[model samples]
Target chain A: MKDRSGSVLRLAQPVRLWVQRFTFLLLLATAAGLMLLGKADTVIVERIRVEMTDAVAPVLDALSRPIGVANDLIEHGRNVYGLALENRTLREENARLMQWQAVARQLEAENAVLRNLTGFVPETAATEVSARVIGASGGAYVRSVLVAAGARHGVRKGQAAVAGAGLAGRVTEVGDRSARVLLITDLNSRIPVVVESSRDQAILAGDNSDRPRLDYLRANARVSPGDRVVTSGIGGIFPPGIPVGVVVGTDGGLRVQPPIDWDRLEFLRLVDFGLGGPLRGQGGAGDPGGRP
Target chain B: MTPAGGTIAHRVDAAAREATPAVLTLVLILLDVVPLRLPEFAVITPSFALMSVYYWTMYRAELMPAPVVLALGVFQDIVGGGPLGVGAFVLLATHGAVLTQRRVLMRRPFAVGWVGFVGVALAAFTLTWVIMAVLHLALFNPLAAGMQYVMTVALYPPVAWLLLAVHRSWVQAR
Candidate 1:
């Protein structure tokens, strides 16, 4: 009996080792194959990505709520300490803004008259959908965020995501219940922008850096630090004249300092300008005509 | 000792104990993807999952096996929106390499284990950077990757200590 048991144990040990080795090799090979497949078959990989994201979006949305509350609590505490000082500043700013408000109203009335005289066809109005940010890029070389709203909520690819006073990013992928917003700071992001002060066209190209550089400006373009950059609407992906960023540095190596306070971003307003962007088949495919 | 329901309870407890390592690793992967909302935190979210993977792969290889690692890595890749299978490849390579060096790591002092972890993190980050550059066919700025590696390595002691405590109380006691 002892000899028989010993022989069985010896056989099982080698078999177990072989099984372990085989499993390891198989998993390694599978992982390598997936990398190649991701490159070769992007459509399927993207589908899987969005489906997985949709599955987890609810959990992420639930998880991020507490963090948002905590952030607000901290912000409130900071504001409380400066309440008196802030109130005075706000009061002064409000007075100043009231003057500007009258000017803006007068300009709008005059512009309407001018448009009527020219028989001009007005551009489509934009609608905004609010979404809460649930996931930021996970320390990879990517700059993106996942928001809780998706195609079901009228969020679509190439819609401009505005947050924290200016443009943040554009929707790159949309699922049934979640969407991924690729930030303007990602390496692959390129935006057609014009320097507002000089009206010189250039492309804002990101290199995985916070300050995306302005490239391909006309040779004689006058670009200086503090020049405002706005969407040029060349591709129709974004509407013209949206506030993008402020230029930094000279014409040689210009960069833009986006107004977004990245750390404090908890919500986004995705604006669809009824243009359907250039990627869509028709101009009005994404038309949600009236303002939200 | 008791019959029927007591025996079922005991079995359930046993199963939970067996699942502790993998469950903890999964939780860490989730933590890695969750936005912390800290200033500049996105660029250096420190590979919390990698730390857990390294710990379990080094000490409890059977519990954190290759298949489990692959599944967890894939989940991380999907959630993080990174290139598919990159996480799996990095983790599987780490698991394979650590298995060969287990004997040495097992007998060493904590400091030596940390040094070993630093070496592993270096290799892992470098491999990831190379794969990303190749996949994009463009040279990525290594500064963020380098920063993440520094933070990951710096953060190992506390994470390992937590895992060690869990292993001692739950896994080893059983």
Candidate 2:
């Protein structure tokens, strides 16, 4: 019996080894096939990504609340650390700014009146979905984030995702309970942007870098560094006038620099622009051209 | 006990033992999904799951099968938001390398093992980087890949120690 078992083991060992080698090669082949398949129809991959995101979004949302609290606590701690100096500075500034506050309040009241008279409505109605960033696509090739929001929370693909400070990115893949945010710094991310001062239109392109470059700038456009860049609301992706980033420098004839600190991204607010169509809703009634 | 009966029991015992590694793999998968915010050194957060698999495959090769490694890799790919087979490819390769080198690794000193880990990690990182480059040619940046490689290597010692400690305790308990 022992001799028979020994012979069987010896014969089986080579077969097992061959199977192992074959399996490894098979996995490699499958990986190559997937790469080719993914490239063939990018849309299918995007759809699968969305479905996966939507499915996992709720779990991400649950996880985000604690992150949000932790962020608030950190911010509060920072505030506390500078409270003594801030208190003294604020007290003197308040004494001087009390006069300006009245003017500011007056202007705000007047602006409200004008908005009412012109039938100006904010693009996104009050309903907002808050999500927590669970994981980051920390690879050099992709600048996407996995957030904890999905179909249950009304987070759909193509929705604008913004951080606490300003625009972060947009939802590209939505699963049942989770979604993926393709940040403005991703190679594939592109936003229709307008230079705040000049209103010069261009496409903000992400090249898998911290600062996305602005492309398609018309020749002789008067865009300069330090100019504000906002969504143009042309592509029906993001709402108009949403702050994206500040123009830091013109690189290769492209305006660059993001307003939001991409490195320290933690939480995000997915904006729900009420208008289900292009953000260029009939310009607020007051402006003859409806241009903000 | 009869010899024939004993052999069958032994086979069942081996199969049951395999389940322990599967449980460990699942726990690692859960850890990958959970955003456990480590205070410092966040960028180079050594992949705990990868280390766990590596350690188990080295000590308990029979239990840590190739299929489990591939499945875990797929799970990581989905969670990490990379192409589906990228992690699987990296991990299967790592498993194969570890298996081939296990006898030497087991006999080597701690320092030698560390060097072996560095070599393995470098190979894995290179493989992953190459696959990612092919997937996104325009987006591939060597500097970022280098930084990640450095972080992974720098992090391996501490991660290896932790895995060793866990293995020791688990083995003792068993």
TM-score of chain A of each: 0.86, 0.73
| Predicted model 1 interface RMSD | 1.2
lDDT of 1: 0.85
Candidate 2 lDDT over residue span A200-274, tens digit each: 999998877678888889898898888898999885666688888788764355657766666566778887776
Q: Which candidate is the best by DockQ?
A: 1
Which 10 successive residues of model 2 chain B have the least lDDT summed?
B36-45
**Model 2: DockQ score:** 0.35
Q: Give one digit per residue, the lDDT tens place, for model 1 in A189-286.
A: 88899999999999998878888989999999988899899999887778898999999995548899999887667899999998854253211122
State in Å the error of residue B169, model 1. 2.9
Model 2's i-RMS, to one decimal, reads: 3.7
The candidate maximizing TM-score is: 1
**Candidate topping lDDT:** 1
Query: What are the clashing pairs of model 1?
Result: none
- Determine which window of 10 residues in candidate 2 chain A has minimal summed lDDT: A278-287
